[model samples]
Target chain A: MASTTLQGLPASPGIAVGRCWTVDRRRLRTPRRKVTEQEVETELDRLDVAIDLSVQQLDGVRAKFQASDGAEHLAIIDVHRAMLRDPSLVDEVRRLVRVERVNVEWAVKRAVRKIKGAFDADDEFFRERRSDVDYVGERIVKNLMGQGSDAAEMPPPGSIVVARDLSPADTALFFHDRRVAALVTDAGGVTSHTAIVARALEIPAVVGTGKASTSAERGDWLVVDGSHGLVVLNPSAAERAEYEAARVRQMEREAELTRLKDLPAETVDGVRLRMVGNIEFGEEVPGLLSHGGEGVGLYRTEFLFMGRSELPTEEDHYRDYRALLDAMGGRPVTVRTFDLGGDKLPSGQKDHSENPALGLRAVRYCLRHPDLFYAQLRAAVRAAAHGNLRIMFPMVSGVAEVRAAKWALAEAFEQVVAQGLPARMPPVGVMVELPSAAVVADRIAREVDFLSIGTNDLIQYAIGVDRQNMDVAYLYRPLHLAVLRMLKSVAEAARAAGISVSMCGEMAGEPLYTLVLLGLGLDELSMNGPSIPEVKRVIRGASAREGRELLDRILDLNTADDIEREVRAEMARRFPGLLEGGARVGPVSG
Target chain B: MGRLERSFVIVNSLGLHARPAAMVVQASNRFRCEIQFEKDGLQINAKSIMGVLTLAAARGASVLVICEGDDAEQAMAAIGKVFESGFGER
Candidate 1:
């Protein structure tokens, strides 16, 4: 049979070959109708019953996951349950039924649309939230139409599930079934809830394919190359043979990575490197350990302040830090202070900037709120007694901010000491994210104990591109000469000052950049927990001398494409099959 | 009828989203008063999720809760507690 391929955004990395199973969500549609004044009471009653049914369905789903101990999944169900019982939604539908004399279905749809319209802001976080609201509306609508949850139609085992979009609830059902080979959706980005759950479940997934459901037929032999976002339908003999070979290679690579987990992260030339994990939630510790993470390089403290109504007290910060430190088992943990504002602005903060990316955020926010900063510092000082705890400040532009931060930290140390709490002064570091910090790195490095380069922000800021904005996302080039120069300069400054230097960014996680980073003289590389083994394999394969030679040759290149091509060729030649459709090298802005 | 009101800033990173909005509605329903939430000059029924969500109150956005009825004071206080505790998110 002739092979046809569909391209999409790679939401999760892996490959799966199975029969296609298209989940028909057409049953969720509700019919529109008009209601008379006398029918208002009946419409309201219908709305109530639909809501009750939706809630009951969600409760049952939650119960199924309750035994699996997946807190994140249960939390998502709770949110859906809350939405079902939301009085504002219920009252709005009832009012619409009476005032507009509309059917319960139309009223519910209108109410949900109104809420979604409000959430259609420029912020990515809020935009992503609209999906949850839409999901709840669909659930209620489905229930109102006397349709059961779509989980009833279980796809055959090892089938690739295709859908227009899969909600968290739907993803949870698939997760429990444990028979889904992969997921392909017509809608959803890499950050979607479906993608996140798919990654957690380790299922191969390709999302945002606009027409994956319509183009592919059910029961077709499909090959989902999730790493490359390619789906081959009715693959020919040659295509199947190629995919089979690729699958075997991928499995062998994975097994090799697992075997290297217990081995030390060192270059072939005997240069030992520290590979740490960047953690936002404490729950990721076990995964970090399994990935052979040496320690926590970047523990974002903003999460504690996030999803809460008030500032976290000193005790709150201390308890979280202490728990994390204890879990690391004496390995050094560097915790960055609340790098709030910008995209991560806490609810209720006024966004006064036309461009928040360049506005007062991170260190600036902390400087303005000294009391809040001091509370976190006091906690870190107290938590230092638990294990090796290091405090770092994010988005520091110059030495003044570092000194001011140090002054605040000293005050916190004194306050903690006065209270007779077990406190100790830990080493303080600054994230060299801004070009200003990188340029003046020598002066800043002199003021701090260490420097951790945040390449994600550094690349975006230096290139003047918002990585999340797809139109201009291609301009966010990590291999841009300016970026490389800034990184090199920062590493040199850290070396000159005899201070430790590390990079905790998305770049550090990609195997394509591992050699270049080491060659550039970065002392440590911290990334997401899952990427450790693959990166370690690269480290273990190449000598630092070869990396330095490759870096020198690539530094003379003018364009990002040239640099990328050179790096890819060298990596492929040295480590065969390592870069074989595995590492996504270019246009990776986010 | 007596009227009582209080202002609160959403502290949760997600602001008056689904779960918190539900808490606000649940708290408002406990009293006989008619409760309304006002944000950015937009007023909405505190007991209505659709209404509260339409305000799109983000973290650090201020919201005013007003209750008018015999149980206005109690309703206002109960709503205040929900915001104060961050709907148990903190």
Candidate 2:
């Protein structure tokens, strides 16, 4: 059996046994500089045809919104429309066609290749704009006579796709092709659009498999366990059988959790924990509520600034903000102010720094750009009157930044009040992502009404490991004794200060840490929308008091290895072998 | 007019992701040069990261750079120095 270790984006759970089919870039046409006036005219005709067909396809996708998950994906049509009319691309293609007298295919490719070079020189927003340029080239090619955007990726029935990297267009192709079981890419992480689509499709996916093509292949015999991010490339027959059995067991377990979807996330011991969603887009609120979320723990506001030209207008913010509250049926929606730091900067403000992950972001960004911050704060307050409102400050390095953010919130509240609006101010809190906040949790928790542990960022900062860095990626242990100890200390401090403690990161949603988080005295757990029902099921079945014992025992453990084994053993005893290979330990039956 | 020259590897270790590429592109914006990079058989506009990564010059590989900007010689010298050291160890 050929065995290799690769990094990838794991989007789904369970393993699949499959064969390898290697598709390299050899099929791609290389540029040939050596053609006729007839070829140029033919290529131009193809471009025009591609433009027409793309317009029709865009309309088709727009009209079929109900068939899909309905997130206004047709917005690409506007981008394509702009590209179709771009004089630069058209002129360049014409120039290439005239110079080389190449066929339409070569002409279209030449123009695209040239533009890609120029576009890369542009800024982030323009970089994103390059995606539009790609569509333009794609349409030109298709019009010239070809298939859709996917480049020769048609898997037979019950097949898996493996690639070096997957563009968003590749994701669209997956939706187009029905036989694809799952896909693994050599690149991209949790935030990639491909991961989002895989989750939406409910298909098993593993991405960020470093050098994915080196190990897994389009037709490689393998089993992929996307849940824990494992891919056994070219498994033996016995391994395939084992993985198949494991998959069946997982499906059965997932079905059990689906049954619990209707059940509330209450303990048999009669403790009620408000399950919340850490949502990115306003569109996600519907699914969050459907999954029995009581509130939104972390409604990340950065998504609004992602694909825009400048600061989103107050009206745009208000419209979406109002929609979220209404979607949750007045459930509490916590809106964190824009966390535009070094890494997550909007295309306009381009805050490039040496180490952006530790640079100006979240609260610091708001303090610097107070006017933009105040507008969002004002809209969030207005949305507050409609639902349970909570303002969360992200990436707070110290108490002073917290104080500054609070001042901005108060000033925005004052403005709304001055405009003859009834003052419905939301409680303010800070995301305890930095170690300084944990060190001084007593003081910060005292100042804030609540503390939501952003364990993702917290773990990253605490261990000084960029979670994105695969080399040190293993050190990003949320269950590390220091992390757990910090969580415990912060939770204790928050409780002592009469404030609620919660977690709203990947760690919070994970089943292994669910009991520990609860036992650590957290009042809430916020996770992905789809993770809600299963986590809730775990809560409803277990004894929270017993969970506290497990948490306490695991908390003081010196090493993470010691704590993990203990927690797993405790979960195993409670679950009676229902928990397998750390399929997350809480309520394994569910 | 003298032109500046330099060769820098795409850093933040993401291989020409949106931000780092933008920084490199933005850096080139200041200089008025037809900066060029050659690795393997691919030769492309150095100012464009798309061209750079499409060439697939992985970490530690030496890329010969040429520039004809306002600071063409300076840019060439500066970028040449950067490439020699893999852009401060990339």
Candidate 3:
């Protein structure tokens, strides 16, 4: 058969040439028969039994996958478990059975529809949540129908999975089962929970294909090119040969990068550079180490505080920090104080502002709640005795905020000392994220031991563009002259103060920007663990002087397009295969 | 015991979504009270997932919780704690 190629969003990057395994999640047809008054009691019993069974099934799934998948995946199960035990759903189903005098399956279907209908269709989060509610309803309906809960079987190992859409629970199961090679979904965007989980699991995925499930048949030879977001079905002989060669080359490049794990991340000119990993959980330590990470540059401590009922006490913080520090084997771990607010607000913390991004968050939130901030500081201080630990505050606009935060940290230190706890004071630093922080970096640098430029927020704030908003995404340029100037100034400020400056943002991880960052005189680059080897390869290939020269030439450019063109051309010339997907340099532009 | 009521803003990033709704349900189940959560002009059984979800309370939305039973005060306090803690999602 002739080859047919489908285009979709590249949710993850890689090439998976495998047979197609289509997952058909057609909703089960419920018998909509009305029940007699006498049969109502029996139907109610069946509904209760179904709900109980679904909850048990979810618990079993959660238990089986909890050890392998970590908190994010387990959280999805937690949501499902919560949905199963949701009193509203339970009460509604019961009421529907009693009031509507319907079969258990019919009652479940109706109640799910009613609840889902209440959600605003315009809101994307609620829309996705509607699917989650439907997934739970289906589970209960299946149980009520006496059907096997495990009917959605795992695909054959290493087969490309084609589905209409995958719920978070299904994604977890597929991820833990390790049977699927790649995922092609008819629905979901890059920001969807499924896509996020796919990227976390390191699985190649092309989502929002809209027709992958219908176009591809079972056992068909499918090539899922996640980098280009192309799914080729029944590939021609020539196409297959080309893809096979590309796959081999990709594998060789990966192996070569892996071999550099134990080597120092020094440039060709012998300028020593530090490559650190940006992590959220302690479980990522092994992966980070395997990627040649010298230390943890950015350990986001917000995870410990989030998704829990109570604030993380000193002991809670200390335990987590201690475990992470122990796993790092004395490598420095810079723990950034809770960067909560914006999208990271804890439940029940209402963000009524029109613009949450620029609203009170991060250091501002901590400043308002000194008690909560001190608890975290105390934990970091107590855990410092375990290994090298550094505490940094996020969104510090000026020296006063830094001083205030340090004052709170000092109080925590005093409290720890009073208790005669084994506490050590780590170097406290400030993240130069906001434009105010960047403009006054010289002053902030003098007050802190180190400065880490969070370019993700820095660029957004400097350029006055919301990165998450697609309409203004074009304005979120990393190579923009304003951004380059901000980064250069921050680095220079840290240098003038004899303080170390590192970049722990999206810019640090991309090979396209590795040269620019090194050229700009950043002492360290901390990024996602998996991107370390490829970035290290680029660092090992060039000299700091060359990077500085490139930076100089690019800094003179007037527009982002010109800067991008020059950089991409230079990157392609220097490192051929590094800039995959043709001229596209990074995973996402800005 | 008398009817006890308290108002709390849904602070969790997801608001009165499934997980938080479930948490509210679990907290309310601890008491013998008939608990109801009122939000956006609609009131739901605080212990019911469907009821809470139907409220469609987004982040920053305020929910008024009422309980009437022998442990009404305790139930109100416990449920209030769930909202206060952002359902452990902060």
For every candidate, give the share of true A-B contacts it also has. 0.36, 0.00, 0.39
Poorest 10 consecutive residues of model 2 chain A by lDDT? A581-590
Q: Is candidate 2 or candidate 3 better by TM-score?
A: 3
Per-model chain B TM-scores are 0.94, 0.61, 0.93
Docking class of 2: incorrect
TM-score head-to-head 1 vs 2, winner: 1
Q: Give the interface RMSD of each candidate.
A: 5.3, 13.9, 7.3
- Could you report the DockQ of all the candidates, in the order they appear? 0.33, 0.02, 0.26
Docking class of 1: acceptable
For every model shown, what is its TM-score relative to the native structure? 0.69, 0.57, 0.68
Which candidate ranks first by DockQ, i.e. highest?
A: 1
Give lDDT tens digits, candidate 1, residues A10-47: 98888888889998766445678889888889888888
lDDT tens digits, residue span A1-590, model 3: 98888889999877778899988877788789989999999988887788788888777767666454545556666667777777657778889888888887888888888878877877776777787788888988888888836657678898998999987757767777677889999988876667777777778899989999999999999887888788888987677777766766676766787789988889988888899999987768888998889999999987776654557667667767877888899999999999988656765477888878888899999888877888898898999877899999999989899999988888888899999998888899889999999999999988889999999999989999987789999899999999999999999999999999999989999889988988888999999888888888888999999999999999889999999999999999999976775322222210
Which 10-residue window of candidate 2 chain B scores lowest in summed lDDT? B10-19
The per-residue C-alpha lDDT of model 1 at residue A165 equals: 87
Q: Write model 2 residue lDDT over A314-381, tens digit each, in one string.
A: 75567667777777787788888787778667755666678777777777777887767887988988
Model 3 TM-score on a 0 to 1 scale: 0.68
